[model samples]
Target: MIQVLFVVLFGAVAIWFAYKVFTTASMMRSALALLFSMTAVGAMFLALQAEFLGVLQIMMMASEMVVMALFMIMYMMNPGGLAAMEMTHQKRLSIAVAVVAGLLAVGAALFGGWPLATEAVAAPAGQTRELGLEIMERSMLVFETAGVTILVAMIATTALAIRRPA
Candidate 1:
């Protein structure tokens, strides 16, 4: 089916980009790879018919990556890592850990006993609107706190950037 094909393609692309993110020497390339990997995850979500989550994933990652790149450009001497340098540390240990973690994740996915709805589900006319309402009603305080925290961090960053060298 088309859904299965899309899911497989997106999953492969996501894994490849994730690998590039960790292995690429260039920091900018790594960030871009991460962005692509996250986007691929959004595509997978779309394939699974989770439109809200898919769009959220894409938008959130795009903004987060932009902020990350700005910070890297502002602070890092060589944001691109053009010079020959080892990007990763503890190579063997990292590989071992990654393999073990991956296997554990696979095992959990294959064996996890997820609860299933007993009755047939009725499709909502406006799933996104319903989700938005639910989130606003249940988690508005958490969202407001996160927004305020981000605003404070932005103000702090602006102050630091404008500070004269002393």
Candidate 2:
């Protein structure tokens, strides 16, 4: 019904944006396409009723993509990728790898021995809360590491932006 249609629409938009990501020569455009694709994926998660995941996906991807684009613009040889240059290397090999990966995913989808649900089961009242707690407890160190990494990156960016004496 509505859920299915929304999922399909989001999936299609994601795929289209993903295609645009690889096809564009402009680095900024590629980043934007990736952002759109990720946003569509977040929308898909929302349509699938995973509210926590949906919000997390959208927020995380948006920030990450913006930061990535900023770095590319600030540091790369071509700041804006305005010149006509090939963005990707080893085109044939990249295509082969992509094809193989797609085939593997399709194979897993078709043949993976996933169990079918025998009956409808209600979600727990505290399912999201419990899941959040479990993730935080198990990955507290990982989160701290990521936070430190981000802090370092921010410092580095700031330092690089500062004007140095000749």
Best by TM-score: 1
Q: Clashes in model 2: which pairs?
A: none
Tens digits of per-residue lDDT for model 2, 1-166:
9989999999999999999987877778888899999999999988877777898899999999999889777776775667777656898998999899999999999999999877643354465776677669987788889999999999999999899998
Residue 5, candidate 1: alpha-carbon lDDT: 99
lDDT of each: 0.85, 0.87
Q: Which residue ranges in model 1 land beyond 4 Å of their true spot? A: 118-125, 148-165
* Each model's total of backbone clashes: 0, 0
- Provide the lowest-lDDT 10-residue window in model 1: 117-126
Q: Provide TM-scores for the models.
A: 0.77, 0.74
RMSD (Cα, Å) of candidate 1? Answer: 3.0
Model 1 per-residue lDDT tens digits across residues 34-148: 8999999999988877887898899999899978877777787677777877555898998899899999999998899878767643344366877777669988888889999
Alpha carbon lDDT at 23, candidate 2? 80
